[model samples]
Target: MLRIPTLCALLTLTPLASALELKPLALYQSGYPEGTEIVSVQVSSMRVIVSNSAQGQVDILQLDPAKGLNRIARHSLVAEGMGEITSAIFHPSDDLFAVCIRNSDGLKNGRVEFRAAADGKLLNTVEIGIWPDSLAFSPKGDFVVVANEGEGYVRDGEGFRSDEGSISLIDLRAGVAAAKHSLITLPDLAGVEGATQAEHKRLVERMIDGEELKIPFGTSPEHIEPEYVTFSPDGTRAYVSLQENNAIAVVDVLQGKLDKVFGLGTVRHAADILDDGQYAPTAELFALREPDALAVSADGRYLISADEGDTDPKIAKTKAGLPSGGGRTVSVFDAVSGQLLGDTGSQLDDMAAQAGVYPDARSPNKGSEPEGVVSFDAFGKRLAVATLERADALALIDLDQPAQLKVVQVVGAGEGAGSGKLAPEGLAHVEHNGRHFLVTGLEKSGNVALFELLK
Candidate 1:
């Protein structure tokens, strides 16, 4: 049963304008044990798919805002030595959904498992590249594209061994079971025509404590790892977020190869970089916009990213010697030219502080890490919703004026008992019965929260 927490508090950042309003509906707990990470939540016309990656299980729920939410079915794949379940997405126009699983060894090839949305029956398993981090369907639903992260791993006495990251194009024209994939490998940054390394040096070297420190922009082709993938409105091209490399890869879908790769550069802002049980933007730092998620506007004019910061060991080590790290902002870019248009700066962190949910423990690291992001149309406005992993809140941003971005509202996880909406990971918005609903999978709390958008 869906239950609303009496202790939850709704913090409205901007005045209730003629914009979208988020009302807390209910929290549906999975009843899983502690550490059961609900990393992904997606809503379809039929049901809601909640991925508990920690336990290798997926829970299917029925979210009827007019009534209540209920779990209809559950699927588990918790055997030893198998790939870890990363994410799941429903087919655009079919009764099917696919789940990405990273190989347990992390260096071997990962696989994607497609299942029927009706009864959660196995459809087919397709092998892809190493560490399939995220996947998406084309605009026409004719193909399923997977971002093969291929992250580097350090073995005992062997030092670091890196894998070449690539994109896997899964053709679904024949059918789901007959689907086959082809790999699209990335080219050297210097080899891509019209691409230059100078643009990526926005924060290549910074002065700290009277010494200049150099940061890695992932200039090498092997250092590239695709974190998230998004398609254009026309499906002619796909935009991928290279988080640790602080870059983006443009893939030509028709040609089945990488078109171009460009860096996201860096951002300068004042942030709270200490875990002293206090929250204040007292330190100024220059950090990379190592975006973790990518979202394109409906019109295909803009590309949005949640600058979650770098996770690469080299980048993290360099940042450790500095003042701060992490993007802590949502950046907007030109979809066609890959140009940085605008960003939210520190507004996301400010909103969390204002709501009294700022995670001081993460201040010394990536403050309120902005991870998952999704864009959609509602209330006669173009908007983007971002998940603040550490803050346990959602940042609702207005993209109407992309350059002058605004945090219209901050839907925070209420405080006190029975409000375990922590570390929101996956997000999906849908309109049902003429009402708009936003669903989020709470990673740490093992719960799913549903919010209704009111006019």
Candidate 2:
């Protein structure tokens, strides 16, 4: 028989400690369109804002967390227009946000639209280069940088034809479109070798429409290759993920030049070597290998990168690409110094492999990729990741122990145990009216899931 006093103390401690553990309070189905791919989430005083790109429209949904997942407002874009909305972000202070809309029709150039956060009213539109995939604001919030996917086309009877890719810099303060930077052009072996009258006509048309342009950096820039971009907390440094090149380029924003280029998989530099070895010890340059998304912690202590693994078939593929493997993980880094801080989410792949589970081979689950990472409550103690594939689960990471960041909770779409479909794409935490919320976008389902974080 246990003593009453001892048992009471144990009960009190157990319940109190359990209550302190971080967990999802509720999960609501967004009821968005089937093809709707939810891209990003931002929380504000008036509403819980979500961005979705599907059916050739950018749909914004406002939520009442207290009332549950009901849409307070909605916005749509026409199919024939610049309909593919790839990324959206809110301004730090104002109720204004920007969306990068990709031109899927191929007739017009890509566009960046600034809208009022309250009702989704379009305020201004800026025409960017082809297939703009991602956008990021400088630390000072004075300018917007875009990663234009650059020319989308296919083969013709004579030979292969593609559009020119480029990046655009838009000055918000100037209230005008800035200069456009063209992607470096590479010598086309097939086009040059198989030159024909039709091929020449296609090239001339491309030249007329700003195709086959030079990047000024290098040759043969792949289509829409610059997939994602992120800025340091101070906005002094900018990092762009060159997906096709398997590299991340560090750019000096003030100088407007590439400072260093580091490969994702190889060790390129000595850790302690620098201009002055006595001070400013240089970090060892290590490769990230298939980096997809970038996130900086709220405190600006760490930089987090999501590695989606590799997809190229001709290259050396890991077991992750195999039918029995799910292959997804997140890499952490020291934000100030750019030092690799190890990786997390290996358990997902290990569990899948051990269970003989594999993602659909043909679909090549882009949704399965770990697309975004965010710190919970802005304390940098807890981290959340959206696993687009593996059934769209949100992983809660414990960052207290810097050496061993572990997943504490895995939240799915429905109330019941793993009852709903979640293809979470992007994540954002916002505070309004003194309350905080966690928001995520689903790519495959085109819905955004909002949850009230338990303190």
Candidate 3:
């Protein structure tokens, strides 16, 4: 078990409404550099795989009921020129796992490597689109989808340039050896079946407005970066987060095409738009729900998003001289229609403040930056676990009543870095041997903290 000197910070917080509690079990140190980030994590049976992005490697660990988590193997560079590991996910039924790796030069396309979960041995290597940032497997374990972000960069002289942001659909029906990779390029907004002309116009007006883009990049089809991906229950559809554009792309996995692109419009709510020491909801601003992580309900009826806010700072200066088009809450939307259902208005930020874990420094920006989210069934209740990157805490929201959503618990991870920031990036929920666990990767602290769900 790891020492939690900071857990007492939440003792004075309000009581949780539900019986669910995250009991801290132990912390597994990555044994890497001090600033090395443990961003992505996934568990299968007794095995766990974590991504060490700064070091460009994936560390495999084994969970023992008698002991704790122990490092089993470390793997890196399935092929030369591969960059940092972006994300990793284990197969539902097989002893296999997939990882998204970007190009070292950041100019070429990336690849997804399938490896064995037992020993982290490379099984298959399939090249995908540029900058594959996130990965997801179909429910039935027949297919794996990669969200190729295709991030843009600026040179010394030339302006910003980017690769076409696309999605990669890998067919693993025959197995990883026979994987068939296909890239689904995002069509223009006008060509998308589910995209509305009015939504497109509003987005352009908010970001461009027929003038030179105040931001660094344009919100064109090629520049629409895919951040995270979640699949439908039946494995027929996939939802991809278009973070910078403040939209979501629905991909038809079977047909292997970009079906639709619908924008997640702005959310006007009470928030703290200043970095002052006072934590007050003094401003009512219209924030663009630039969702970073997404999760679809098991019934495929509701799509939930953790809006971390990726709006450009330059654009915020133009918007009433305040940080308006930013994300700081989780939102719920109708899965099929892409209609807004309900969102936690200022609840997340408020809860963090009350719990004494809110990052007051981030108030002027996206406070509490809820970056990673995962929905799972545990303790006879449907719950969504959202990681607050800036606050170094986890918000557990009850999803049984989607419309009447309640934040049941807000638990702090542990002691943060020397700068008082843990920066929890990726989250994974696993049920093994009759017990459920929430494994979180703390990026700045270089540790994977395990929490056992208990009544």
Return the top candidate by lDDT. Answer: 3
Worst 10 residues of 3 by lDDT: 200-209
Reference-based TM-score, model 3: 0.87
TM-score against native, each model: 0.85, 0.69, 0.87
Name the weakest run of 10 consecutive residues (lDDT summed) in model 2: 194-203
RMSD (Cα, Å) for all candidates, in order, is 6.7, 12.4, 5.5
Segments of candidate 3 deviating more than 4 angstroms: 1-16, 34-44, 78-82, 154-158, 190-215, 314-316, 321-323, 417-420
Per-residue alpha-carbon lDDT of candidate 2 for residues 1-455, written as tens digits (9 for 90 to 100): 10112444323322112122234544444465454443444443444445556554554455565665556556664455447777777665576678888876553578888887667787888887777788887756666777776646555564555565555666565542343332322222222211111111111113323455322112244332566777777776667665544455566666555565444442222122122212111333222245667777666677666666433331122133222111255666676556666565343332222222213231222213566666544343445454434435565555555556554444553332122344566666656575556666655555566655554
Q: Arrange candidates by lDDT, highest first: which order?
A: 3, 1, 2
lDDT of each: 0.73, 0.51, 0.75
In candidate 1, list every pair of residues with a backbone clash.
none
* Candidate 1 ranges with C-alpha deviation above 4 Å: 1-19, 34-46, 156-158, 190-218, 312-324, 414-421
2 or 3, greater by TM-score: 3
Q: Which candidate comes out best when scored by TM-score? A: 3
